[model samples]
Target: MNILKKVILIDDDQINNFVCESIIKNERFAEEVQSFEWAENALDYLKNTAVQQPEAFPDLIFLDINMPGMDGWSFIEEYKQIPEEVTKNCCLFMLSSAVDRKDIISAKSLKEVKDFFSKPLSPEILSFIKEEFICS
Candidate 1:
């Protein structure tokens, strides 16, 4: 079964968001792609919608590590507080340009974060995620 129906992109960088959104849409990886420049807004959206319509939650979330407000780390922390019904079925991936070893280790340690990827997510990575996480 195809598990990617809706996807949420939380990155403050517009260029990154544009590129990622373009790729996700062009490849038909997800039926819907919602890009947010602020992680806080994304969180609020999920918080409000997940309860009112649990199925409206995105199947996948691509989060950026650094932002002016509510960085990815902060987002993850806040994400944990959201209801389980909103987050239980979805996968979260850290998409960042930072290559710090400490950052990598930190991301891997988080149960909420499924994986980490360098900037400009590739189609191959998405395919693998779909096969390994979604299809299974």
Candidate 2:
């Protein structure tokens, strides 16, 4: 498998982040994994790293839709303001526990969001993602 350089998990649930990080590491899906409880913090990291060290920017991002401060939707809005060169290579996916059909439709409609998946990253899903998005 082609391991990604970095991946970011933006979700309020610490347990979910821990589980997802473990799964990513065990699967060797990414060399580095960073988890953020706040979407704003993740955005700040992206903004700073994208400008200072583009290579340090995450190759993939798993964003949750129901964060306390800034939800995934708001994060996408802010993300759009970042430079295209910095974000062009980065793949963003919505990883939320929300079962709302509208949420899925809304996420899929966004240009930035590559795909949507339910909470808790699994090895199977990661494999599919690696094959379909990263390796392709």
TM-score per candidate = 0.95, 0.97
C-alpha displacement of 104 in model 2, angstroms? 0.2
What are the lDDT figures for the candidates, one per model?
0.89, 0.93
Model 1 Cα lDDT, one tens digit per residue, 19-90: 998888877898889999999999999888777888888899999998988999999999999888678899
**After superposition, candidate 1 runs with Cα above 4 Å error:** 1-3
Distance (Å) between predicted and true CA of 112, model 1?
0.5
Clashing pairs in 1: none
In terms of TM-score, the best-performing candidate is 2
Once fitted onto the true fold, the runs of candidate 2 whose alpha carbons sit more than 4 angstroms away are none
Q: How far off is residue 72 in model 1, in Å?
A: 0.7
Deviation in angstroms for 26 in model 2?
Answer: 0.3
The per-candidate count of clashes, in order, stands at 0, 0
Q: Tell how far residue 7 is off in model 1, in angstroms.
A: 0.4
